[model samples]
Target: MLTDTVEIDQFIRPAEIEAILDQAAAAPDSAIEAILDKAARFEGLSHLEVANLLKMDDRHLPRLYQVARSIKEAIYGNRIVMFAPLYVSDYCVNRCAYCAYNECHSFKRRQLTQDEVRDEIVEIVSMGHKRIALEAGEDDVNCPIDYILDCLRTIYQTQADLSGEIRRVNVNIAATTVENYSKLKEVGIGTYILFQETYHQPTYERFHLAGPKRDYWYHTTAFDRAMTAGIDDVGAGVLFGLHDPLFEALAMVIHNEHLERTYGVGFHTISVPRIRPAEGVDLSAVYPNIPDDETFKKIVAVLRLAVPYTGIIISTRETAAMRKDLLDCGVTQMSACSAVGVGGYMAEKRRRETGEIDPTLTAQFAKNDERTADEIIAWLMSEGLVPSWCTACYRSGRTGDRFMALAKSGQIKNVCHPNALMTLSEYLEDYASPEVKAVGYALVDRELEKVPKSQHREQARRNVEAIRSGKTRDLYL
Candidate 1:
């Protein structure tokens, strides 16, 4: 059954998933320690093992957090990768019940022109973000593949009026054919991200009522066509509140397993986005299924152990407090100063001081964290976390199976650590506020000492001074 093609039925079996969770509920306490020990060693866990850990009682929660933190420290070190989201359009053909941009809504729809995208980039770069996830709603006739390509080209090529550059662009769009994905690859996208929304076919169909997205097989197999087209680094996720979170988690692990067996690599990143309040969606049917803070932490920790090699992303949908707490439970990447709407960043930035609204800004979902990117980055540093701006791996040739091998062997730290500090140096020089710049530079020096090799530390020191003296930009290992 493990063939070259993607089969939805084989990838996610609802009955099999139900049985796994049911059995895990009766698993002895000893099973928990055994699984946690393996996870601590970074061997990763099987879906059945993850299911049992998901059933961990309140008493085992501390050990779960400790193992997850240890694995994160061993693999990714202490830096949290940061990126921002730029919504090109909220125009859509879908009537999904959980979205604010559901086609039925009468809100004004807008897509960024090349000029508008340049301005958004100016604002985004001004905030010190070197990477961004390009977001848009699904509408083929109105917002064609050509438009998406144009936006990608504009993002990568334009040197904004303001002083900065967006080095990496990750795109999230509707499912399409292999040829279209190949075109995106040619246009130079970093990661081709598509969320499964939920793996339960019945609920998937129910929520995606009136769009091409309603096709369960096409939506689920998106990664297959993408990888087939040679875009191997794809990020996968679910909306998280649509079905039982435990079942969804198990199904997602199975989905990753299928990709690995067929394509020789699993997901490059896994995003855990919880469904939140949207402009026009009916949430009366959704509130009951939403996971509270404690349950959410449990799921995130289990996911860390379930897929140890992949980067896990949490957006600004969660509160700043919760995002801070999640670090201990193994979240490696987060979006800072993110905009969930077309032109939201610039719109919010200009009126930020006065609290005025920008008419052009329209959000797809409510964001719980309202902090500016700079404020958040400052808070992260104060809490002893490195706010990294590195895209060296992507810009370098390390991706897909190549990146996986380095990450699995725990050797990525050699380059990633120095690369993160070097980029942080660039951010400090070009964008950081005077006070922030001073603190950031000091932190860079301290972390530079831990760069693992005398040679790397020397090179990083020279690069930092070069950036400080305005001699170079975009230096990487």
Candidate 2:
């Protein structure tokens, strides 16, 4: 089962955390420019300036957004990395007060067996998702370390003699021992994700009063442990509504800095999830800290200005209109068609109960924006954004620092956009709905017209037809 029984506690020293925050707080606007210039030249941002940017005011927000957009153009371009969350289980061992999965809640819990998990992956893969984030609750019985590893191994190894590939499998599980982190690396994870929820110590304590995750340092320094265990790419983020947005944003920058200083691998991705009304959860009484839309955009834009090279991900916790508006402003990655229950993707007759399968019995904080993956991609195309499915970073060793460099330069689009269209065409050919296909085909034709040369356009057309004709080739233009 690859289970490790060791009780490990690896944390960043409090003095180190304090030192970073102090430097960040002391940095000035000129200092921030120096940092941004260095990032442009060296392909990495200074952690301190990122934290400083979070403190920027409304007066400078517009300029900050412009710089962020320019930086995004240089690095990621208009290509939006697309993925989906495959909920494997909803059983929890933590009682964090703000979470829907808290154990104190009387909601039913459930887990997917190996076959059920494979079924879920099949559904996701059919939707042309090359990357998936595995979401699980934190109970050993419900989601054992061995089970998670097996799912990954099966995901990667199952199609050894098959046709399609599920290129990357990112995991979002609770904090665990370095030993477990090592096992996950051995199992081959793309990115190990665990949100600090909030970085304010007292608030963190109050929010997570009765769980092992309540240990602030252990949870906060998980990426350090992951990096220590040789997991090159790790993602860090926060639940924005749990604490003041400004404070959380500052803390996130500080946390990214700590990783860069200690392990030389800053967060590869930063996610921002706001609190949503959920089953058995009272949003008003529990989280009075939620930021409004304008404030949320500011937080996102500030982070972009702060960490010019890092990938920013926004999830379905936001509405369609909100996501559409924000994509070009700062976000680079997003989740579509996410369901927060085990076996939730199975067709109705085929669906199995993950804790009763009742609407009132589900684990999601709220219904997602309800756009299918196809619908989302079509929307991206309509907006002149490329829906990317390329896993070149991991495959080509451009992850971590290598990836950061290319992203900061704005040079990544040359490779990313064409490849994204290639992958999008692959999805459209296989599983797109008629409405989706109509929109996607038209978008492809339109985007092809934007290609610089007729020769490149001819090759792209051939690739698209190849993809449609079920004779897909490697997508290296």
Candidate 3:
């Protein structure tokens, strides 16, 4: 069903790429300010407008930032979707030059056993997270498709003996066969996420020097394969620092647009992961380095206005201040307390259980935001933003294309807001610390007043009690 192999090389013309870069490099402050103001009005930015914003200099960067922030607030509102990374394996086969866990790095690698993974789920559940993005390094033999399926099975099977549970588990692994994609669909994941580190074929070829991941066609066509396998919800992203951000952003938007055209489904989430420090990895040594803060913020804002419906994810790679600031500027999803090591949660649990600390597992990368899940929720509430644990969109058959339909029509908020409030209430009743719960309760009351009807308020109130009384409730009201 996938039309004439979807390749990044084919979709992004060299001339177009040069044009975006040229525009970025030569844009003036007046031009940049005009684009920002225009984008803030929700009329959406043209390719030229985005190029101009990227070209904006530091002297006028603050104005671009203001525009990005304004556009973000207008589209996404104050809801911040929270999830955590559940690292299933750190064993990789690709010899990518930038990654810390690439095969050539010789770092100690580990894969979690099913029991160990279950324990990790318990730890995350205890901390009040309801959505998890499962992460694993690409290794067919070490971390095969079956192994991922088992991990998903264990995650869905685990229960807290309480009301709230891990509602969604998004997958982030390397590209694989169509049969494997079908297996992933059978596993019932919320989103199948894969990043095409860079869209420039030559650079992509250079970074992915070895292993199956080197097959650029297979990697780029993963969304098509997943869709063919009945996995309608897939996420696409790129490592911004690997290539020119301007080129990558345009390619990314085009990639989504292509999917929409062919499969009637686009990426459920589009992530903008920048380069960060990792063991044995040096980002500065690489060409086309990380974008500065202003550039990064502008890229995200332009993406938001371009594809307003897709959930834009920014991860723990960003510092806390940067993350908090960026949330209002276009990012709708974020990770909390991520542990990119096998049995990391078990190691923590063992330390607590035995009253003795064990050696920490070798992490794949360093996480900047070390705040626990509880602390993050408290911060969001204090900022008057609702930290959501909702997976209603995924569960209620409103994902990928269906979700986009709601989002494009400006009706997504009707579902997103109510579900966010409901999920926040569940977190408060079941897992939050007393102080955190008190703050959450107050915030819920404030948020409920903004809900259109008294009926939803009553249903939300009842659901909170149901969750407290050990009765599970569906995400929909």
TM-score for candidate 1, residues paired by index: 0.96
Clashing residue pairs in candidate 2 are 74-410, 75-410
lDDT of 1: 0.87
lDDT of 1 by residue, 292-344 (tens): 89999999999998888899999999999999889888999999878889988
Instruction: State in Å the error of residue 179, model 3.
Output: 2.2
| lDDT tens per residue, model 2, 81-102 | 9888888778888887766777
After superposition, candidate 3 runs with Cα above 4 Å error: 3-9, 23-48, 56-67, 352-360, 468-475
Candidate 2 deviant stretches above 4 angstroms = 1-48, 157-165, 347-361, 409-411, 445-462
Worst-scoring 10-residue span by lDDT in model 1: 1-10
Q: State candidate 2's TM-score.
A: 0.86
Q: Specify the highest-lDDT model's number.
A: 1
Query: Each model's TM-score, in the order given?
Result: 0.96, 0.86, 0.91
Better of 2 and 3 by lDDT: 3
The lDDT of each candidate is: 0.87, 0.74, 0.79
After superposing all C-alphas onto the true structure, candidate 3 shows an RMSD in angstroms of 2.7
lDDT by residue (tens digit), candidate 3, 1-477: 554354443665657767776857787666767776676666666556656655667676566556656666655678999998888888888888877778988656788888888789988888878899899988889998899999999999998746546889999988876788888887788899999888888888988889889987788888888888788888889998887887888878778767877789777889988887787787666755688886788788678766666789988888999998778667889887776677777777677799766554667677788888888889988888999878887878888667777776777776677778888888888778999999998888788777666777677767666665666755565
181: Cα error in model 1, Å: 0.6
